[model samples]
Target: MSIFGKFHVPSSAFALHETLTAVPEMAIEIERVVVTDEVLTPYFWISGVSPSAFETAARDDQTIQQIKKLDEFADSALYRAEWTAQVQSVLYAYTEIEAVILEATGTDQRWELRIRFDDRDQLGAFQDYCERHRIAFSLQQLTQLSQPKTGGQYGLTPKQQEALVAAWEAGYFETPKEAALTDVADELGITQQSLSKRLQRANQALIGNTLVVSAEYAAPDAPDPDLKH
Candidate 1:
């Protein structure tokens, strides 16, 4: 049985510490990571700062070997970063245990990471490893991925479920809208942007699980009757 864990690590203890500190409002969402030849390369999305500003800050960070902007949008940009080999942090620990990173987001204040471990033992080992290396992390939530239940909660993680329920109860989905986005975010003890992201993911999961069907399960298309031999 796999287990999902959410943790919070202070920015000072994680990668991109300098860059995030310089751009305090910047938010990062790691898209994927690749480790090869003892070097870790991560592709991530960055928001709240211009590409030049982010690049300048990243260039000065000792932990980063190189940074490249892959794509840019009005408010956010995608970047790839190669971490220096000498920099060992929680990310290295994750790769050591072969844990799957479900979601990883960071800010100047802290980093929120959701990781999936093979089982209870794997999760325990990860915790132990962090302790041995004095890598400080606060465990936010731990959930066992059990058999799916056909209930009101489809396949949402605990945080997502909480956000969705809170939003609904706050009348966020009502025609008149009883509560403001800030109000809901404050109630959930998170930033408005974080709340919005969570709600979006929750809605997507709900629709995908309930309304959408796999291609194999969907009805087959009618055969074409065109006169082509």
Candidate 2:
């Protein structure tokens, strides 16, 4: 199992907020920002360009109509811009670096940026920046789902467990009926034949017997290698 960390850092960076106000047609309230700064430095460097470029690009009024066009042409481009900068800032603090994940969210004067890293030092630098900037920050450790203990006493394979979860979500047991078997199968990317087999196994293991096993089983193996795609 891999140990992962989550950091929530608040920044008063007005650059993003100012950009939103320029386009009246586009109304976006940030629900959250997700980012990975696995290998980023602490300093951000813009190509010999003046800081005003950022300020001007966001506050420019003449681009209002053009910005509306952008919404049509590049729906997710603005969001991508926001995500890239927020991630790059922490990752490229002093130099170019690869990031694990970088996410940003919020609106107006309050924005939360999250960065994740495998190494502790990168996370430390981000924490330091948050303290120096008076940004509220939090750290959460992500437990690996592949770990053995998560199975709890059922001794079900992870795939079987996941299929059972999908059944519940699909409302297979619901009164009015919910998601179909094919729906769940499609979501899991498995043949209906496979999904059914796993779901049945999970049910029998979890609910069939009166006496339940108290011991939790760990994963037999790590995640599938093909899932990276």
Candidate 3:
């Protein structure tokens, strides 16, 4: 069975953390990360204001200084680097465990990673790796993804169920809007785009299931006046 795990690790123990911590106004949402040899290539979005400081920080900060190249795209930035031994350890752990990160985001305080693994063994190996690294890791949620969605969460998948519930509790869909998409996404341990897609799908599923049958033309058994045999 596949395992979906939401985890947190301190910024101090991770790369790109310094750059984020330097700009509290900035929220970084990772689009993708590739680990190879001793290098990491990460593509991410920088939310908030347009940033000039990113280039400067990449040159100045000890962690970010390791970056070999930085490319700015229309919607996101990408960095290529030979990471530190510490960062290597973290990435290597994923390899040994057959795991992949589905989503990751970081603020000044910490990094949240939503990772998926092929099975329990991979998870156990990853857990041990965290313990060995002395990384202060917190597992927020874990579910077996191979199983069918149950619990009558309105036919929502586990991640969708969690995201919808989190958004509602955080008031993302409420009157006057108690919370913004950023806040709701942050609370749900996902990026804003990911959260947007999840909420969209959830809303679509709910509306389709609840209201489709009520349409005047929806009933299958009713005689169709427009149809002639």
In candidate 3, clashing pairs total 0
**Which ranges in model 1 have alpha carbons more than 4 Å from their true place?**
147-229
What is candidate 2's TM-score against the reference? 0.36
Strongest candidate by TM-score: 1
1 against 2, candidate with superior lDDT: 1
Q: Mind giving the per-residue lDDT tens digits that candidate 2 earns over 1-229?
A: 2334554443334234445443322222221122334322111111112334433545443211112111111112222123333433443433333333333343333434434354556556655665776656566554333554544345454466688788898897798778888889899997676576557656656653325543331112112222111
Compared with the true structure, what per-residue lDDT tens digits does model 1 show for residues 1-229?
8788999988877788899999887777774566666567777777777888888888889878678877676666777778775456545555678786656788888888888788898888888877888888999999887766522245455567778789889998999999998999899777777677667757766776679854222111111111011
Give the Å shift of residue 167 in candidate 2: 7.6
Model 3 agreement with the true structure over 82-117: per-residue lDDT tens digits: 445446435665555547765666667787887878
Evaluate model 3: give its lDDT: 0.60
Task: Return the top candidate by lDDT.
Answer: 1
lDDT of each: 0.71, 0.42, 0.60
Better candidate by TM-score, 1 or 2: 1
Better of 1 and 3 by TM-score: 1
